[model samples]
Target: MGASQAGGLPVSLKLPGIVLGVGLGGFVDGILLHQLLQWHHMLTGTDSDNIGVKYYSPYTVPGLEMNTVWDGIFHTVCWLAVLCGLALLYGRLAHNRRRAWTSRVLWGWILVGWGLFNLVEGVIDHHLLAIHHVRGGPYRLWWDLGFLLLGALLVAGGHLLQRSGEPLRPRDADDEGGLR
Candidate 1:
């Protein structure tokens, strides 16, 4: 579908919004859960079910160190994604001759991107890979399920917001100048 029909924002803008959302979402997950809360790490749930060899721990000094390193790597990847998004946004804005930054469409796409991140990460880390959980304990499954639910909510909310967004207004020549 065309940009206007798709959600009032072009794919050029939507792509960057999603990329930024994923990057920022990753930061939130890493910072809040991994460091601040001390709940889980990249390898916290590894081999918890005896599926494979265990690697690290969240409670021990060495294990924490290793996990910290892995977390750093994860953060680096997130940072790179953010940079890529920024680059894409810059390229689009510079060449498209359209103003997309001030639209709700961008925000909606961002939410969708974050939801996508949560769904993929939650499934991969919490379920399929057994790398870690939102919070470790007997109730881990519940926490993981809750995370997925939140993701679904975000996606739905974003979709609604996107549909409700208006088209971007063209820039007027007289409105370009700053206050005298």
Candidate 2:
């Protein structure tokens, strides 16, 4: 709830948190699975991968280069997400910036955002579009399912944590006695 929102309430950290989380989660997947482990690339998925032939995108140097370029584009989008999140966060803070940074509500929303990214990405990229996968093999379906499961868990956990948080406020805003 926020003043600009439909009802009268202070702004929550949900938007920024989710944006940051989605960006962070993308970074993790790109760095760990795509670059470091060489599990897959932007356009690596093909029917050949399903049969374990390991087509490697187009199976040539040019294809690898193209995949690399696509990966760069993906990274750029993720970077933009992070920037957008920061801007939203700055707008939300009144005089409790420090406390908001450490608030459970913010972090919880971030977790939810990350989970949402995983769910949406996994569903669209891995299953619907067939562009790529967590990995290529007979067990690819299992890996994809596991990714979705992890996303669900994060969402559930984040929701639970967010339920316990209060709205942000300036120091002593709610306390009549500032200090003892």
Candidate 3:
């Protein structure tokens, strides 16, 4: 038997996929929204009456700097997640690593991971903690809701697509999906 069994297959790409997806998703959020677009920062939404979060206005230079630092920290965590996911996936593949790289199952799970990231982050940061938003101001609520909606769609889409993915059969693979 294989280490990762799913319906008599050794395809266990779920964990690493989700982890990698989360990291990549965070990169998208940090780069596009935080850096390029300048929509919001880590502490932009702290102005809300959240229980214990300190507010940091992006308007002031010091506040911006603080948010930037915290953003860097967030990016670091995301980077580690990507690294960890890569390590996990790499370690799991014993044979036919090439196919695993291009597997639709992997991609599908990655999308699901990204969606999960968006959903979790949006819920905790945007709605719950009020740390930051997808886009802040009058339409911030709409943007946040859209983010969650997008997450849901990605998860659903990924699930359906992944269901169609077949397990890879390596030339030298044994029962465990590894080199014999």
Candidate 4:
């Protein structure tokens, strides 16, 4: 029930892993919407004709001129989250010796990361600014809200699963998996 038993590594390692996961997920959205899919950065106050049309440059928004300022902000926040998560993880590893620090289920982190991405994106895009809507129609507001809810559930469930899968104290000599 300790970090050493899991893989001779601290539970804090998991934080960087989680941050990397979240950052990757965020990058996908940024690439698709801001670069590839070309969706307007919903938070930037730019409007698209609909879901299928080509995106035009953002109109004037107060002092701001760029259309994807929101995208910039989103990327910044995502990177910051990753950094913060890493710092916390490192700090925990440095100070704590509890073997069973967290859970062994890496999948839990994956799920949590996915959930967080959806939740943050949905909130920033649909609710705070109301740039477009989930897909084009079909009650975008509720859809976005649901996405956030789904993320929360994923995070909660994943953590629970990880805790439940935790191995017992005195590392199982027969185990083969690398430090979780």
Candidate 5:
């Protein structure tokens, strides 16, 4: 659908924003939770009791190695998502004469994208797949819930911001090209 029907944001810009947000948000989660905080790993919950595979320990040498590899793979996927977003943005804006970059719609969609990333990842990894938790302890559920709550807030906040922005209008054929 066109921008006017899609809440005033162009698909060209919105899609890329969301893609970039997901990638950047994943980087934050991977770096902050997995690396800096040392809270959990990709397969921390993959215990033999649950899946017939030995429990993964982030402390032991072998465990750490395995987790590290998995983390690397996760990061690679995030990087690829960001690259795809960049490619989309470049392709969409390359010939456009409008200054869409400065539009609030771009940032709003980015927030929505990041929120979506958190919600999807939190639900799939933390709940459905049961591959890991936000933390390993009695309070793990609380942490996971808190993560979901934050995602919800982001989505709500982003939607509000998007709605507050002016709708993007199509550029006239005679308009000069370049950012406004």
Candidate 6:
């Protein structure tokens, strides 16, 4: 009840919100690392400097068609976790409060997502094509891994705070103590 959602949106809509959050997070990662930072292309099959592929963004809409199987998979997982959280928080079968083990497990999965993001990004961008290093160093790959680890920690911290009684609603500002 404390969760401050819009007046008309149903609880079922939380799943889509979770999916969108995860997917948009991926989009930001791709844009920042691949486009801004110039780390790697969407698909690592070809070199970034390749004439044919360089100018063409494979993951974009028309000029370059692509597959987002991996992104979809991760988003699906995030949606499931978010659904579970919603269920535990509001569903008939669940208690009003989240269970301890459930929160811990969710935190663990967050770590998994972070690791997966790092592995896929690292293998494709750093190791395979040797584009830009993670942070421009001899062991830039390790640096990138460390960043992933930090993100995992942040997710875990966020979940822990949520479990401590913070609301899950997106629209609320002050009442929401941690990450959205």
The numbered model that scores best in TM-score is: 3
Poorest 10 consecutive residues by lDDT, candidate 5: 1-10
Each prediction's number of clashing residue pairs: 0, 0, 0, 6, 0, 0
Model 5 lDDT at residue 84 = 90
Per-residue CA lDDT of candidate 6, range 16-117, in tens?
Answer: 323333443455565565457654444433343223333334446641343234334544655564565445435411122333224433344344444445
**What lDDT score belongs to each candidate, Candidate 1 first?**
0.76, 0.79, 0.84, 0.56, 0.76, 0.44
Model 3, which residues run further than 4 Å from truth?
1-8, 169-180
Best by lDDT: 3
Candidate 6, 179: how far from true, in Å?
19
lDDT, candidate 4, at 174: 57
TM-score for each candidate, following the candidate numbering: 0.83, 0.83, 0.88, 0.53, 0.83, 0.38
Question: Candidate 3, which ten residues in sequence have the lowest lDDT sum?
Answer: 171-180
Error of 3 at 126 (Å): 0.5
Candidates 3 and 4 compared: the better one by TM-score is 3
- Candidate 6: what lDDT? 0.44
**Better lDDT candidate (4, 5):** 5
| Candidate 2 global TM-score | 0.83
Query: Global CA lDDT of candidate 5, please?
Result: 0.76
Ranking according to lDDT, highest score first: 3, 2, 5, 1, 4, 6
- In angstroms, give how far residue 92 of model 4 lies from its true place: 2.2
How many clashes in candidate 3? Answer: 0
Q: Write the residue-wise lDDT of candidate 3 on 1-180 in tens digits.
A: 353432334557889988999999999999999999999999988888366778888999999999999999999989999999999888777566777877888888888999999999999999888888889779999999999999999899888777778755433424544431
- Give me the displacement of residue 102 in model 2, in angstroms: 0.9
